[model samples]
Target: MKKLFSCILCLSLMVCIPVYAQDVDYSDEDYWYATCSKVQTSQEGVKACVGFQNYLDDQFNKLKEEMESYKNDLGSLQLNSSRIEELAKKQKTLSDSLDSQVKNMENQIVEINKEIEAVKVEIEEKQKEIDKWSDQISTRMINEQAGTGTNILIDLIMGSSSLNEMFRRFSGIERITASDQEQIEQLSDLKKELELKKDEQERLSDQIEEQKERIEEEKAFAQELQASYDQLAEEYRKVEADLKQKLQEQAAASNNIPSAGVISPSVEVTVPSVSGFINPVPGAYRSAGTWAYPGGGMHLGEDMAASIGTPVIAPADGVIIYASNPAPTNGGYLGNWTGWPYGGGNTIEMLCNVNGTLYAISFAHLAQEGFGVSAGQVVSQGQYLAAVGNSGNSSGAHCHIEVINLGSMSMETAISRFAASADFAFGAGWNTTATACEAGASAPCRERPERFF
Candidate 1:
């Protein structure tokens, strides 16, 4: 019986040992078993529970940190239109990585469930042992002649051959009861530990589930971006084409020379006292006639051909409508300062009214300092706006003067008219918008049927 009890105790301890990587011990019973523990169910249960709990803690912290980093990256990506493709690619990679991690966590959870089942079986065996011992105690009580402490004393008196034998019987019953009590205490501790572990496992399971859902959400978002990428590329292509076309037309118009004797009625009338505004550049080589006349391409406006320090002059009394460096490849007379194929390196536009018609007179190919005029300042004709420099499509130092009507024409139309009209000196000096340029006066004035392209 002594050997049998010892074997039972050893087997119980062994039951809780972990099959996984670590050991778990939530109570004194677990430590006690570990000390006397054999390879059995109770020992394995304790170890597995502790191991699973540790795994849960480690994984939860790792995933939480990763989620925070991903959110921050996404926030930055949202602000930049140029980084859209790169952002999508990175998001996809993160989603895939998260999926793999979630799978690993879930597999760990499955192992935890199996460990719990093994613990349950061990607990059931312990309960059976408690019941068997309880029955043995009940039988000993009933079979004995004594029923109470007084009855036990009288029975000992009648049955004893000597006082020592009576005392020994009493001591044996005490020992049995003590052993039962110890077993009950140990079983109770194990049961409490098992309940705690089960709760922890449930909590971790829920977290893993939530993470899986989040991974799925991110994956869906990545797919959505992939689906839209092609469409965005096509739209970008269209925008690029439109911008290139406008730039080319602008360049051509700036270089054109108008045809003579082909006067359009729209530009026929000249404003009074216009001659006062014609300030010539000093040392400029003047063409004898308007650009329309033969051999007259010798620079429409004063080609100051000035050095970097030469002061730029505003051609008329006007408010500064635009005063800044030109964008790269903006092209044409306005875009000259920026240099080109597409020109208009650094430039400015000033709005002046002649006989109630608004005109935007622009200057290009200016020194850097010249591009910094205050918009809306009233500038006198020939007042310094900036310095001249060799900064544009020109072969040498020069400034390009171009006139425009700010009458709500689309930029493309304005460019076309300016180019086509440059051939006829003063042909670009229209009182109306470019849309009305070739319309020849009609209701709801339409563009000329001919398309420049």
Candidate 2:
């Protein structure tokens, strides 16, 4: 029995310990070695295991502290939830701004193209006009020169028909020459202006390109930052998982040590369900009184509230043991079913042996028919046994359950000798009805919840 208890406790402890790796201060090398290298045999082994377990816990706590500090730093920098939200808002604003900029740039490009096209058309028209004017001027100059030779140029310029006619012709020629020169100059200036306009359009295009590059850089940087945040979150999760596993393991190891068995005479006992079980009331409650004294400060069996006359079912397969009327001794008024000190009023008990372990299932706050089935009646899991009622000293309608563990001796004697086991299984002021029956005396609690068929 001691060996069995030790093995079960060890397994449970292992399951409870956590395993993690963080920035741990392992400066006490001697302690670590001593804690880790201790062999199992006596109480020293148990102590060493507990010390190691505590060390692991301390390491995890340190890691948690580091993570908290990191979280604070992340807060200082715009990196947490609020920061992400702000960044998202900023990103949206930037996106909208970029969208507007792109549209404006596109519109500008279109307008620039139109302006360039207009300039090209104007340049073409100017070129044609310049060519026509040049041809006309050349023709007039040539004809004049042909008509009046170099020697006649001075005479023709000074004299021609009457004075008024000569003046008019001279002015006409001067006006035409001046007008042609002016046209030529204007056409040259227009061409130079067109070239400058083309240069301005190119510069506008460069600006658009620069804006695009800036947007891309911002997007890439945002992605990198998000990736880093994801990595940090993942690392935190891994560390937490390791820490939990190590804690479970340490707990398992600590509980591996067995209690010294107390010798006692065996009695005719009935065991309960091995695996499948459920709450008879299907709700929560608190115990208001004890068997000895009805009114009590400390709670007894756990109680669960239900509607008046709610059907109470058996949690597991067992034989009806005891079904009794509510006694005045049981405390009636209690808090909500969820609260502590579960109360049981009228009680019905069932006894069954599971994997060599004997257990009793007590149903409290039963209606008029305490046990629907008689004693020695076989019950299946979730079988309706009776309707719940406020028959006992219960404030409301609720069911009280008790799981009694009969050790090698009676509860009365076991408490005096193997108090440790008694305390573990059935201590005072407890509603122990919520018990997970074991397959054997040494089996772990892994009961399937009861279900109505």
Best by TM-score: 1
1-453, model 1: which lDDT tens digit per residue? 334444554565443324454544433432432332222234454455445545545754665566566556555544233354344344444444555555554554465456556656765665676567646644554444233332454555796666787887676556556646575456545544554444444544554465457556545544544444333333232233234335545646675322321222233222222223544244443222212213222222334444554666655566554455543221212112243223445656555544444455666666665354654456666677876654544333566565544454433333344334432112332123333434443222322211110
Q: Candidate 2 versus the native: TM-score?
A: 0.27
The TM-scores of all predictions, comma-separated, are 0.29, 0.27
User: Candidate 2: where is the Cα deviation over 4 Å?
Assistant: 1-273, 283-296, 326-345, 369-371, 407-453
lDDT (10s digit) by residue, model 2, range 21-76: 23444456445433333222333333443455456446435544544554455456
Instruction: Output the TM-score of candidate 1.
Output: 0.29
Q: What lDDT is reached at residue 350 by model 2?
A: 60
Global Cα lDDT for candidate 2: 0.45
Count clashing pairs, candidate 2.
46
